[model samples]
Target: MKNNVKLARIKANLTQQQLADGVGITRQTISLIEKGKYNPSLKLCLQICYRVNAQLDEIFWISEEEFNSEENN
Candidate 1:
């Protein structure tokens, strides 16, 4: 999975800890999400999108290959 979380965070002028606090998660979790090292749940994704004023597709995206692979996996 790929996300534009870092971009959104920067655009919002929010630190990872601030974003985490607003989204009710840990700073490490926000760091992981920003780094694309972790995939957040759909609910968490929604919360993040809401806080950042981004659409779900804008934040979390499945590339063509990834979409295909996911169906098979």
Candidate 2:
């Protein structure tokens, strides 16, 4: 899935490590999430949203095609 985690992080003036620290996750995990290499659990996702002061959809919303494909899995 695609996300705007990096964008929100930048808009919040947070480095990846800083955001990770705020959310209690590893910096690598935040990097992976931004790169779309990992999908965070809902709890973790909510943490990120809260840290970045972003609405869930603003950061973690996926494209319709991606969402549809996931439904097929």
Candidate 3:
């Protein structure tokens, strides 16, 4: 999956460490999330959404491929 976490984080003037600390995760985890190498749980997602002041759809956008795959299931 892809996300705009990095962009939003940057726009929010938050470093990876800052966001991770606020969200109670590791900086590496935040980095991984930005890189799209890790999938955050719903709890973590909510934390990020609130901290960044961004909507779920804005940051963790659902790709067309993922949406179609979900429909298939």
lDDT of 1 by residue, 9-44 (tens): 888888888889999999999988887678899999
Best candidate (score: lDDT): 2
In order, the Cα lDDT scores of the candidates are 0.87, 0.91, 0.89
Off by over 4 Å in 1: 66-73
Which parts of model 3 are misplaced by more than 4 Å? 66-73
TM-score of 1: 0.83
Query: Which pairs clash in the backbone of model 1?
Result: none
Q: Put down candidate 2 lDDT per residue, 1-73, tens digits, no spaces.
A: 6789999999999999999999898999999999888999999999999998999998888788998887676
Clashes of each: 0, 0, 0
Give the least accurate 10-residue stretch of model 3, judged by summed lDDT: 64-73
For 1-73, candidate 3 gives per-residue lDDT tens digits of 5789999999899999999999999999999999878899988998998999999889997879886785676
Better of 1 and 2 by lDDT: 2
Tell me how candidate 1 scores on lDDT.
0.87
State every prediction's TM-score relative to the real structure: 0.83, 0.87, 0.85
Model 3 lDDT, residue 24, Cα: 93
RMSD (CA, Å), each prediction: 2.5, 2.2, 3.2
